[model samples]
Target: GENVGLHLPTLSVQEGDNSIINCAYSNSASDYFIWYKQESGKGPQFIIDIRSNMDKRQGQRVTVLLNKTVKHLSLQIAATQPGDSAVYFCAENIMEGGSNYKLTFGKGTLLTVNP
Candidate 1:
């Protein structure tokens, strides 16, 4: 119920511009959140993470902001580049079935950089 469907599947941007990708999570009790970037045919690489205690976190060329009130999260990428083109996913860690930790993922946002 908290999944925010994207109005557009992909975003095209010029090189050196900033890009913002958004995601929505279903559970408010989720404790940990991570943003990952996956290049074509590659595994998702951890970009940044934010905890429930914090509302925002930053990494090299990227910033992640969380809004617990609305269960929304966003990733901001500075200086979009051809190498930055990839699919990004936001994941939330939740307790499932006993003591197991599970990560639920959003559909993903595709970023295309035009050189």
Candidate 2:
């Protein structure tokens, strides 16, 4: 899991297991959050997202959980695999005064799937 204040450069997981990555945001005004997976040199790929109204959301093999009280977000990946190995990031977006907002990213967590 990634730390809130410290950067977690790597996370090792065994194949066929579940992987959980964590992130914390600084802005309580952030209404939207997203999880992204990035391979070595590739761009960040969107995985899942949750709105402030919702506490949890599920995808095919992933889950995103939001805790507004703590300003925390987490991503759970089912059946960890070699292909799932990558750097994961959490991004937050807030719409201010109609349509202007900034997308901010937290320190990434490197996920390493060990066969």
Report the error of model 2 at residue 7, Å: 7.0
Q: Model 2, 15-115: lDDT tens per residue?
A: 99999999989989999999998887677799999999999999989999999999999999999999998889999997778889989998788898999
lDDT of 2 at 103: 91
Could you tell me which 10 consecutive residues in candidate 1 have the lowest summed lDDT? 1-10
* TM-score for each candidate, following the candidate numbering: 0.89, 0.89
lDDT accuracy of residue 22 in candidate 1: 94
Cα-lDDT of candidate 1: 0.88
**Model 2 local distance difference test score:** 0.89
Off by over 4 Å in 1: 1-8
Candidate 2 regions with alpha-carbon error over 4 angstroms = 1-8, 96-99
Model 1 Cα lDDT, one tens digit per residue, 40-93: 777788999999899999999999999999999999999988999888889999
